[model samples]
Target: MMSNSKEIYESITTKTIVAEINLSCNDEQIDSISLTSEDLQNTIRIEAESSNSTNESYCSNIIEESEYKPDVPTEFVPVVNSVFKSLNLAVKMYNDYAEMSDYKVKKFFELHNHPLESIEERPYTKKARKMSYFEKEFVVHASKAKMGPTMAHKIRAVLKGGYEYVRVKVTDYKNLRRGVNIILCYKDAQIMINKMNDRRDHYPNYSFEFLRDGDMLAVMFWADEREKAFYAEFREVISFDVTFRTNKYKMVFVLFTTVDHHKKSVTVGAGLLSRETTESYEWLINAFLSAHKGKAPKVILTDQDPTIKQAVESVLPNSRHRLCMWHIMRKLQANVTDDLLKNKDFKKRFNKLVWNMHIKPDEFEKKWELIINEFNLEDKRWFNDMFELHDKWIHAYFSDTRMSALMKTTSRSESMNSFFNTYSQFGNLLLHFMMNYDTSIQKQRNTQKELDHLTKKAIYKFISPRPIEKTCCKSLYKYIVL
Candidate 1:
């Protein structure tokens, strides 16, 4: 039998919907939305045959397997155990579905809207009544008699120790509503509340905040949002090449910046903080991986500080860590004779030749060797000083793509150091801010950090003084964000 083209086309025109739904069986739920052409092929054939009363070939399944995904376009994931509240589930079923699969049974009462007919292998079991008090509330694990603790409970207890306290019940008796409130005296309540803050005596209550912390803490708070989704939107990379002053050589801070950002120290407490070790580099990495995951950077420009190198290796080993040529050039500039510094012509030519090292390593070396020969550099000890680890400092790997677009410089880190300079200049610790005595203060609190940066930049420029050039460094620039 044959059918007209228009009739055949009409049969295949309706939209095909693929959705993922939860399938609960005997206290278990599995989400899978993989409907292959074969699975729907029979249905398609039956509908077509009923409509056409004629055989026809349809080619809608011609798309590649690469395009197959049964989830809603923006649904992100097919299913989450978070969707159902009554299904406390082996609560442990979360740890490993396999364990839940092995241990699940049709215990006593069928808990949810869908019921399990038999005590078969599955994840969660129905809850039974014999309420008990949790630390924060009065509650009970469903089927406490047979089910025991859920997987979530087992994992939670193993990770976080259990503590108990009295709670005041806030109840609306008429509405069958009650809430448990922790009972704490002023002292205990204040102490816990203080700890909740970053232990800062003062903080500007914010309209918005970007909190960077460990995965464990992140997951606990934003469990529904992203467990390990701390990613950085970086435009540049700057390095703070300094060791901590902590008694134990702890990682106090990792000074960093982006071209489109500001220079700031990543200080997430030292020794046994939210993490285990105090190794400055290790903790530095903890901050980076915590902040920037998956979006591997192109390069990281740093100084030749061993501690910093260790931190970079642990956190972003793949990122190219190049020595800030500006810093290196300045270091040598100080050793350079006044005759060299004063002679603008010589300095200009010398500076031009040195910068070439970043772009064309071979050409820079060839030109440098020629310049040395042209100017008796061996006699002056200039050639001897530039050769050690020269490529490691100036090559493409360490070259910041973001910063290079600006004139190459470590001005960002220098700017941050300038900010730290005000405290550094005082050298003496202040017992308090004395906010009540603003008349005694020379500058506004808002201006203090900026003043420090300006002063430091002035001092660095006085010392390094090639010129004031913008850097492509991302984070450092963010500090002065408009």
Candidate 2:
């Protein structure tokens, strides 16, 4: 009878405490504290029974399954038998026992203090944004196709019906591309090397060389069988120049180009260098020479880069190194006075003297001295420097060099670089750059084949009925037929 009375008293106390806690907590906090009152009551009853037993250790099996029926919702009521009938009553009794036993019960409400974001704004959250496998693959293929992130995103939106249907944002596409590049940064060099190796294995004439600084690739050069054949035939005069901003690593793109029989710019070979130092240029030149069985061109045209000049001199000691006339002439305004450049008489005489190919070197020198004296430009630093290097730039000095007149400037290389830039981008990975380069080469080759076909089928209407004209027409391309 006494035990029943005590149990009744405990159940009332638990219900009062539970009500107080419920009143103090907010709805969110109450939700976060997932522990039900029934569970707390079960624990309290177990502890009480264990304390009364001699064993002292709590055993959960003391509560029989028959004592608590399933599907019976707990409520606030008097304790019947020994089973817990009320969650509120159980919680209050557990708390009182905890207080007496000096147990500090901590209610950890794991709820966020800040208000939650709405469902509409949740997708824009950083944690919620992600790119799936298909999306990443799309980005990779799109990048390879020379489409940027913004264009790729727009195309995806169109394919998906609308921008609203797209799961990821434009920024996500860009971020994925950037992440892919970062991941491939270490493997790209090796991948390129392997690709080149495979090509060389398949085509015996394809050649490539690479230099590394520690484990990082520093320089690379490559030439295919067709390019090698082109070099062998049209290797008399080749223009070499470097283009910048062509890859993610900012590597200098070195191009060796020459005019083919069709008067088209053909790529002889190409290279990439981490830096444009004299040593790097020398290595690249040596690699090119090695690829072509050490046969240097008769005349090589390039810009006014002293490092390239030094490399050419050291590597191709026998080959004539000529400066690009266009590169030098383009700097006239910056190096000379506006008044001097604008003078019609000066421009007329200067253009004639600089461009004349029939004049001898001695006559060219005399004429140059006369122009300087007439213009009163004796103290001009640019003129003095150019005069010192006159042999490299003056057509009269290297006039005898075979096909030198055909490529007097590096314009072919510059044009070829522009063509490549159309297929490539400034933010390209090494693999993508090479892929685009191959595509460009294939397009040029196809164009060359088309031109060859047209030339073969062309029938000329001769203005003069001369055997020499007919012979020339038969031997030369349509553009070169005179």
Candidate 3:
């Protein structure tokens, strides 16, 4: 019975040592314990004392004292001494932990030394001014209206004297702006959902489709009543282009556009896609075509992205596809030397070869071969590919077709891109982008209406009085003397 009790006493003592080490060593000291188990054991032996004795405290007194002095001599077995020198390291680690905890405790009390100001009252000691509930409501409404914090804060200061509200600094508003944006994210999404649900009344025949990948919205295509009407009126030629990172969602903004009679760009359809894959392009194109009653345009102009090209071909098999001449010409400058572009003779020759209206297909081939060999660009892949795909954009091929809108390039689409860039900022909320787009489209249609009125009612000055010219002039509403 005595031996069993001794064993139990030893077990209890071991547990007491473990508890003491745990109470003494802090989170920072845990890494030290992991590295050196022998040091940990030594620490436990030195720190843990008999719990059944008259002294009942377990590490409370030692923690308060902070200073730890070793009881034994340092000189011992050299090999064992070398290994257990980590016990001193463990002591240093505990010291740092204790110092940090004490500093934190001091700072915690120091921060609370001054009492918090009441929400209804301003600071009493200083000439402290606080924004009133009315001012806060105005700032929040301004933020929801998409006014920047600096401007909102300035407006708040301007209204302080007239009302009883106190003026707050821009610095105070800066902190509130971040929380406001987080709230606006979900608020704006819910607002868009409401609009999308009730769009049938305001935008008849409007269509919208969305795909979601788990919780995140993946792709969406939308066409309003105006877009559908524009497509039906002028669907002969269309330019398809996609702009990236135009909204807060980092979505790819796709637009289908065409030129009005006055040569101004008009949007036919618009979409936002989450990815640049072939599947997304296909879905967007399908949605766009379905919205327009699947009436394919005679000619579709675009860049040389293979996925978009393939999607267009698959969706609209009957439409003739054409690459943008300006995009192809950009590659011409990029692939060639700067000196060649600057050289007067080379520049003149290159422009004539690219833009000459009188050059036949055989003549074009002859001139192209000569230019390639003269410029030592025969081995260039870009030059060779343009040569192979000459039928798509080399004006001579499609100039005879009356249905072709003669829009061999996507320059108008590029113009639309720049126009939208001015109104729609990067990382803008999706709903804000759509709202700005409404204003932009309205401006375009208004300009077109003015131009149409001018074309119908205005007269033109004639250069000559020849009978053929007079007869030609009599057949038309009005003509501009070029």
Candidate 4:
């Protein structure tokens, strides 16, 4: 009976191995293969017997087991004759079945090979960096408020709790601002022109003129209603001067400034020109006159630029053009010898002669001639040229002109330029420049209004009991009550 059972078990095992190989061979074409209860019983019996077999017999059983293929493939396969089952065969079989069933296997990685960023540092990463609508609006408003990008970012960081919560770097803010400026630059000229037109339409006294060079803005001049009124009231002593490069295009900023009733620097009109040529200056002067109803100032003070002199001569021939005494005096050191400048006696006398408001032109000439003779500077070209143009700069020559004493220099214009520099930037687009200009002008007007209020409300005790003093205090501005 035992011999018969062994023969039966061996025969069953051999049959099971043969069936498994045959099933695997047909696995590519079959949908699936199922085993009967008898086959499962036979497999269990074979595994039990293999556990009790001798070492050599177990090794032989393992060899046979490795050679036997399963009906369905698995990820782990036994080696056959030192060669493992081909993964491509299993993959191809899976692919064919997947194609027939319209199915796909998608791979996903849940673990990363590299170290991950901490939560605090994640916001600064490129993937996490972004500007929201509110953040962008804040940045734009900050820019309009004259805040720089880094400052704006800092403010935003504070508002958002911290820099980590801001979700963007300072460079991102700068890049966004730069991009916005670039977009604005494309429409700057047209937008400025449109704004001017709109202002002109709304305010009848608001005036603006522009010259174009091949569709590009070359020159622009503008004066609001308040500025026009300022020009009308304080038009006697105008100081015109060009500021250093104040815009992106490297255009010259020509400001027409004057002293108001409060003796504060007032910008009556302003212009931007591509070039500082005579023609450009003439156009600007003409525009200024046109903006103010062609009411030329009685006396205009400016630095001694030949182009400006020619422009004034051609445009405002009736108006007296006086060179700025301050500018000429500033040039004294450069034009004169150190020996004469070092002479305290010569410096005192020269300054006294040049600044003497009460001196007659003949006396000024005689004193100047004596100084030149004493300094042995008769051969100095700058001195000779300045002497020849003495009538334009010397206080004695043009002092008789009405309101000429109000402005002996272009200092008002210089102050106005410095004031505007606070509001405007060299990299501003034309539209931004105009906006900053409007902001500055509005500030100036506000200050003027404040002064006007003070003049009207404030009372001063009479320092001297004189009718003229009382009358002047009541009539003139408080600042002019000297």
Stretches of candidate 3 exceeding 4 Å from the true structure: 1-147, 151-180, 187-191, 337-343, 401-406, 453-457, 461-482
If scored against the real structure, what TM-score would every candidate get?
0.36, 0.67, 0.62, 0.70
Residue 385 C-alpha lDDT in model 1: 58
The candidate scoring highest on lDDT is 2
lDDT tens digits by residue: candidate 1, 387-467: 655655655333436544442455665654444433222211111111111211223224445755674465322334344
lDDT agreement of model 2 with the native: 0.77
Question: Taking the tens digit of each residue's C-alpha lDDT, what string does model 3 give over 97-185?
Answer: 43443311111112112222233344321334455667667765664444666878767756765223534667667667566567778
Q: Which numbered prediction scores highest in TM-score against the true structure?
A: 4
Per-residue lDDT tens digits for candidate 2, residues 376-423, read 999989889999999988989887876777788898899999999887
The residue pairs found clashing in candidate 3 are none
Candidate 4 C-alpha lDDT tens digits along 368-450:
99999988889999889999889888888876676677789998799888888887878877777777787888898899888
Cα deviation of 104, candidate 2, in Å: 42
lDDT agreement with native, every candidate: 0.38, 0.77, 0.66, 0.74
lDDT for model 4 comes to 0.74
Model 3, position 423: C-alpha lDDT score = 60
TM-score of 2: 0.67
